[model samples]
Target: MNFSVGPPGLIIAAPRSGAGKTTVTLGLLRALRRQGGAVQPFKCGPDYIDPAFHEIAAGRPSFNLDSWAMGEELIATLATEASAGATISIAEGVMGLFDGAAARGRSGTGATADLAALLGWPVVLVLDVAGQTETAAAVALGCARYRDDVDIAGVILNRVASQRHFSLVAPAFDRINMRIFGAILREDRLALPERHLGLVQAGEIPAIDQRLDALADIIAAAIDLDAIGQSARPAKAAIAIREAHSDGARSRLQPPGQRIALAQDRAFSFMYPHVLRQWRHAGAEIVPFSPLADDPPDATADAVWLPGGYPELHAGALASAHSFREGLQKLARRSIPIHGECGGHMVLGRGLEDADGNRHEMTGLLGLETSFAKRRLHLGYRRARLRIACALGAKGTEVLGHEFHYASTVSTSDDPLVDCWDAAGAEVPEQGARQGSTTGTFFHVIDRIAI
Candidate 1:
């Protein structure tokens, strides 16, 4: 058997969170696709939402490359596997180029810079030139000089007011010896809709294709597509990926069972693509059902997984889904392994309070009650050691994951699932709840502890 080399790639990053990284990434993906290029898209951290939009623009599934939660070998293997046969790959950065968790992982800090340095890819910073022109070049120069290992190859000016604004910004970069990739004039029409978590799900947008096409047209006309394509370098890991197969470097999460029942649809759509891909590669079969559609878990399945999504938004509909609730209860009674993450954990509880303070009955599999009426943000990277054996892993197993939600726990009487610690290595309270063979947690698992 022969292995193929992965595609050349680059990272699209920014100086801060709201600096048009997503806009530039989506537009670039669509623009490259429109130019008849096979583009593979990727996200830098543990983001579920942006990858959905990436898939739409790139016409392929986008995978998360979390340096903190995942080991270097896993990241390299996944990246190489996902980029096979594509002409180029584009990874959208997280908060900022250098922003990351306080603690480092197996590699460097989980920053976009770590990924760029690891993959030998160049970073194209997207600068929001709203209020300043030459000052933008200063920011780029500082980022380029801040780290020796990571390369800041070029800069893209977003929100340029006019030709005068572009003229001022372009020459500043030339003076600093920084490459100017393109200048995007201010366009309110290109902004994607947003909700609490982030942008509204791509499927929710009725004119998603039309919007993406518009973005492609704008980006194609403004940016230098050929130059951007030429700048990409083949992934350094791609050359050594074949060795990963012989070294026992593979997915840390074991298949829950031979046949798995998965909750899907808009309400439960936060499942990771790589997790499912690993399970399938390990010979596990996934059968999907919709709780919002009153569909029950497949009875033939030996395990059931309910991933995170906007369950709070559809509390009333979920409460009224008698068949779905009954099926879950039946599965639990039969001793089948069942696990829930974030929103799914909320639905597995005794009750849920919606944003309007209305209460709705849930499956009552656990003694947990959650309320969105009194929202409190819980966001961070987590390191967890299992306190009780469940679908995720056996007792004493450690896992790396993250939590990002606005729901608070009202009450819980079940045994704790994991002894958890935040990214700073500070021990937090015991998290999640477990009863019988059922387990649930707000933490979304990315990978297990590297052995």
Candidate 2:
């Protein structure tokens, strides 16, 4: 469906990571929603985590707009689609506004600035002004003048000390003509606890609504809500996607099976929104089952999809889950194609060692050994060429994805499932494993290299 009206949209970005962009973005989403405004939230880049929080805050599903993994047209189309009926769309920027995958040979390949420039969205910059006085204003000035394409509409000073601190930074920003929307005082409660994969999943966090409401109250008291609303410039008119215009080898996104039984529990929640959406768009029925509740895949389904999530955290429960294990094994014996990624990949292995160094028995479908106890952070943007005709793609089909996990592979005796590389196309040795009808990889697919 086309957006009859081009909705007002803005990008909430920061000078760097740990600069309170997520907190401010969540706060603003809740605050705006409370004021009877329909808010659409989006996270830039190939992140599965932040969008979950965005959804919880805005009471609507959030989508990703990746400048690296996704094509420019897809990004624009997704942006328009995600905000169809919303009053305003707020996109939380990835990393620094201008910092993209510089090694990828494209300006703004993974950056928020690229997405902002593409959609002509004004940027509401969040500056974590903890210790700095006038220097914080200097940073904002530099960012505003850095790129002409990205319009830095306003600045929200986060973690300010007091009236004296705000006074010191306020004059400098005013002098440079950089609009300061609000100043948030230093508050420890505004921060969220994080794991190796960024903040713990929104579902796992207890009292999540209360936490978001507290953050919203903080923003409502400090920030200029009307100013932020007014700053969201309308996005460009929606354009017809290339897939619609041409009949070339476009991404039809066939579902792995006609009746796809998706493992959609707390343990397997990292499914990409676009692919699931595309599968439905292509006439596939998605049957969801909860592995965390010790439930099996819908027995009538043809294929099984165990997406990536925090399986390591619940390894004990999974190791003892007879219904899920026995049911999945029955499917595997019937030659049903089952695929896993990251955490799901770990669950598919022979065993997984938790952070406490306790080994838990996993489904022995693939000859792989994984351990989170001996954690090794493997984080990167990946480009994969499938070595076999596996669940991911056909032989030699290339896909753009990312690997972000704290689990280390202890052993992988089976043949490599995918010949993988970092975003720059340099070879990454022995990236994944495959057996009979089972395939597992640490890399989470964003899209099949946006042909």
Candidate 3:
């Protein structure tokens, strides 16, 4: 369906992870922007890192559009809002094109296909033609035939060894009438840096622009930018216009307060892009403070939001951030709502033990002890039912969120935060802890329930 909200858009997806989706997506985004087009970037799942690189490539803020954790209505609202004021919107898919949460939706539940069908965006599948040449076409053909809701418009061959390699791979697609865009040569430099979570955050890498530009050069030389732009189209279904209901007044997640003191630095900077955007849309004022730089939250602000980042890496510095600790302590004393997620939750504990087993003093707002030394991966979509009403919602209210952390709880208070369930609704142990007005949890809320 054609959308009047913006110009044509497309999804860069693949059969699987490590199939060069990120590289191709970034390259195409950079290549598109290099031509002086306004590009709006998006990631299909609950990832914060990829959107960072997407922003650097597109020269604008990239938002997350999750189908599993978030309701379909919320995802469409986010996509519609993100595409505003742009020539084109490009969403990089999570995992394989068909891989998504287990649900009964338009496209195999929460798969990238679901997101594509939801947004009415055609997909350009990226195939990694590493060793096999002709077999790549079979894979692309399977993806095309497997799903009816999604449109597999074209294919881009990545990691081709030579011209001969392209020749062997191109004919199979040609024979099948598949549009083959371009074959990217095998290059090690195209691989982006990685860490424990995913691709290194854009800010962590030095000269990311130069790196993206170099990638763009490689992609532009190989791919057909004009053809891609022509094939890109808006959502097939018309988007429903949503009116802002007074900065979070009718928010899914209860607004912390009218004035929120948000922690915004390298250490605590994983706030959901859409959450803050919608909060502002609701008319709430955000006051940012740098806890990593030893800055304090504004005293006048009523709520303090500590987002998750790499606080364990800077445990010593945070332990010594006099103003940050003192200011938050002051707020805690005033019974103001202080919410912490993931690493921020670690910082709100009595002590944080880094990877080396060295303990560092924390805000002591929550009577819990956590450590990175005993790291255990807890990663998945979460559905939480509030046991008690705080800032999130009234008691028994539900919210959709995701948890991705490697910190282990050493100790916790008797009072728990919320009861959680996996994506499929299996009950999880009551996770997180609450003390006074302070609430700490590893779950980073993506969206509250549609109701």
Candidate 4:
């Protein structure tokens, strides 16, 4: 059976990080939703936060489309699945349009440009014209001319000082025949709060719906919604590839268990939507429990998964959760499969030292000890080959994932879980640990090798 291309979409990108891509993307999503359009939102990399905010604005779940960690078939399949029955899809780009991993990936550089070129979608460049005026056009022109495959459809002048500022920038784009879709004046209230990782997760914000409504009001008044709608194009190339390789394209990461107990809350909220979606699609059940609420994993669960999040912020409370701690121990004794990633890995350790240098007792399922007191950034894409049989896969199974955390491991005595390498194919120290039924790593798995 052949699968057709899904809805038309546009990629929201910028010249660099913090160039107002999120703001423009969120505003456009809410604006289009308010106009009665069914908008599907997606993120271009291994991000968990922006997609949450995108969900709120679009009233739909957002999926990550990582060109580096995921294969072309998986990326295209995810985009096609998520865009079904939507009027348009809006993918928020990661960093700059061309910035990506240090080395080339299975696709390209894992850049927003790669996704754009792969899907045949047009890019709406968001230019932060705060410091300069006409020079912004030069930047857009550089991005547009940077690659022959990636199409820069139009430009959005963000953080403009005033009508005068926009007037100066508008003429430059017109001279170069570049479309100026919109000009949003500088508004401090429009900015989202940020922490060490990225924007504070969307759920933490109070009255977030009101904030999105206000954003939609501003964007609908400024941006040309009609023009943007007209510029979108379906993922024709991606759909064709999927159709030609229909049999092999159906592959997805195997679910950890039949009844997976997933830890979820503000402290452990970084689980990938696509992962869970695939699990459900495969007929696996997700039983969610909140460690922040001191809730234990369901007794009927055959396996437990602890996703990464901001456990450091709530280390004190977690230390006092007797029930959650006891439940994990019981599950491990039952020989049930258990896995953790990043913050979850930290929580499974014997102890965790918060930023204040206060040590808190954890589940102690593994011998690992972690510390946020002397925080060190561990951020990169990883190629992991499991050393022992676990929920992730059989021993020696390779998986693609990423490690993004600031916690340092003070100690660990358990056997290593995976032999790891960086995106550049250089060998890194072995990562993760396994003891009996429990296994964990700072790495968050994205997809398994296709065998």
Candidate 5:
């Protein structure tokens, strides 16, 4: 029932991708934090990477605000909950404002614009003014006129060449009447590295604080933080927020003590925080253990969970983690339910080959071999139907989740992790995989649905 009432605001974004949305967002977050602002940052959509930088900037755990996956009530609830103790909130938008759950001709629904319209937040367009000058104004103008739903507050020009470039671009915005927020200097320090999953899981980045601080300073010098803070409007009436435990009514019949040991480390970090919270609310005590730390679960837990992350990066360490491997084996021998997600799915395989084509041993629970050698990116918003019993549910259970990874399984058998479908209703081969009481897959279960 906790509520947040303060100088909360949002960042409406994206004229396009690679337009420096992430950099600008990170810079603003860091700069605001540096200025002694309790900035609660939220990433629109189901992205895990951007939230990492948000956390770094806000000095708090950043949460995802997916308009597509979650209902409006949930969005308001999450935003209000996250904003409780902060001076202001910054919601970094995803993709282009209009770009949504799917490409132009698709059926999926989540998008930056969709979120903006739902939350009633102002848009601060981060336009890439690299090649075009006044035409960039036309682009911004078109975005403004394209949808009456978005409130295009201002513009931030990225990759500016010189004062000369702004000299030209600023005039164009003047012609279109879009206020120019600020221009980020085209510096290498402001950029973060990217890979198949997104910006190399923030944990993988060395000297993360220094990187964040540098980006913050760069942005602070450019942006007027006061104006940005002023851009935040008062949230809707207090009744708008849903309770954190609002979804508990659906799980009144589930039993308690079905304990689960979750894998948490650089290799298995794709878990949704809300999901864990809801599981606990639903009578499951989730025990967290680390594969990277070479630790095993205490023998008392009834189930094991390995969420997704960069297992490919630490295949060597994970393969050599005798305590964890033996512990999983022992737990499986005792008929304890074991489940794995993307990176977890890979870890349960017989072997895992890194990006370099070198193979390493894994837990071998699923008798599958996975590799990033071929590196076919399987990214999508997935909907799955359980065809058989597993740790979280039984056959015929439907769940909404996401798939984001670059590794693929080299399977000799047709046994899949789970029987599922995508948002498009196409049969997804392995919603997840199972061996005895152990199961793993690339699906990211949405916490809201379970709640």
Candidate 6:
């Protein structure tokens, strides 16, 4: 559908992290939504946390506009399409505006500034004016002038110490020919809750709206909401895509099963939004049960899928779910297809040992045991070649995915999960070992091919 609203204004960020970009972005989204403006939210990189807050603010699933992963044209197209009904679109910056993937090179991940220039959207710079006053203006001036292609829309001073600080820094924006969007007081509650997997996946937090409301109220009261809304400029052109992957053309149908129960709760929430959307589009009915609540797979389900999440945190609850255990055991006895991802892999194992060396009984579908205490950071991009047939794909099939975990398997079979290839084409060991109808791993599949 063609969007009717004009192009939205995007936020151009700093050259570093911890600059309060996320807070300012979230505040604006909530404030706009409260003001009755149709606002669509977009993030500039591959982040799961911020998008959760964005979805809360916009009341719709917000998509990522990654310059590196998805390309600039696609980013522009997503912005244009998303902006169709909203009065203004807000694309939050990543680490920093001018910071690219590398220190200096063409191969570095696309930076926030690169995306701003590509979309022809004006940037409202959010500067942390903590210790210095006029120097803050110099930083804003430098970011604005560093690249002529990017237009500096306005300046929003964050973490201002006092009224004197605002008075000291407000003129710096005028001298540099930049508009002052608004200033925000330092607030602690506005800080979003976070865990290892990123801002505590939205599904994990039930009171997310309360947090968004607090942020919106603060931003609406302190910042000039109307002027900031006006600061958004029409994107010169829609986000475009030059090269498109052929995953949509090659459809992989999810095999039919009477009852497909998905493990969903705080412990199993790291699912790709598109995957579920596509599954429903492909005529698959999904039933959800909670491991955190000690609920097992419904007896009617013929297949069970456990996505990744913080299984280590709820070790006690998961270990004690009697109904969940008995229900899963019943499914296993019936030869059901059971698949697990990072956290799911741990739960299906023989046992889970917490950081304090406490072991908890799990589903024991596979002869694997995971430990968070004996952990090592495993972060990387992966390409996999499946050796056996499963519910999601066929044998000898290829899939692209990523791995982000800090858990190790204490007792596992020698057989590997699937053959993995790194970005450099070097082969790593198998991601996880599989036996029978159950499959699992530490890797999070990107699903280049539709599943």
Better candidate number, 3 or 5, judged by TM-score: 3
- RMSD of candidates 1 onward, in order: 1.6, 2.1, 2.4, 1.5, 3.2, 4.2
Report residue 70 deviation for candidate 2 (angstroms): 0.4
Candidate 2's residue-wise lDDT over 1-451, tens digit each? Answer: 3433257899999999989999999999999999999999989887888999999999998888787887655666677765788999999998888888747422247888888887889999999999898998889889988989889998999999999989988999878888999999999899888887888889989999999999999999999999999999877665434445443225434577889889898889998887787678767799999888999888888888899999988899999888998889999988888889888888988999998999999988888888888767788888888887777777777777788888888887777788787867678864687888888889888777423
Predicted structure with the largest lDDT when compared to the true one: 4
| Model 3 stretches with alpha carbons more than 4 Å out | 1-4, 104-108, 242-251
Q: lDDT of all predictions, in order shown?
A: 0.89, 0.84, 0.84, 0.89, 0.75, 0.73
Instruction: Write candidate 6's Cα lDDT for 222-267 as tens digits.
Output: 8788887777776764434233343332533343354679988877
**TM-scores for candidates 1 onward, in order:** 0.97, 0.95, 0.95, 0.97, 0.90, 0.82
The better candidate by TM-score, 4 or 5, is 4
Where does candidate 5 have its weakest 10-residue lDDT segment? Answer: 248-257
Q: Supply candidate 4's per-residue lDDT for 322.
A: 91
lDDT of 3 by residue, 1-451 (tens): 2233455789999999999999999999999998999999989888889888898899899988887766655666667766788888899998988886665422235578888877778999999889997899999999998968788989999999999878888989988899988889999889888888887788989899999999999999999999988888876555544444522224355577899999988888788888898778667999999998889899998889999999988899999999999999898899999989888888888999999999999999888888889879988778888899776767887787888988888888748879998877788764777888999888898777634
**Candidates sorted by lDDT, descending order?**
4, 1, 2, 3, 5, 6
lDDT score of residue 293 within candidate 5: 96
Q: Going through the candidates in order, what is the number of backbone clashes in each?
A: 0, 0, 7, 0, 4, 15
Give the runs in model 4 whose Cα sits over 4 Å from its true position.
241-251
Which parts of model 5 are misplaced by more than 4 Å? 1-7, 103-108, 243-259, 280-286, 412-417, 448-451
Question: What TM-score does structure 3 among the candidates reach?
Answer: 0.95
Q: Report the Cα lDDT for candidate 3.
A: 0.84
Better of 5 and 6 by TM-score: 5
Model 4 clash pairs?
none
- Candidate 1 residue runs with Cα over 4 Å from true position: 1-5, 242-251
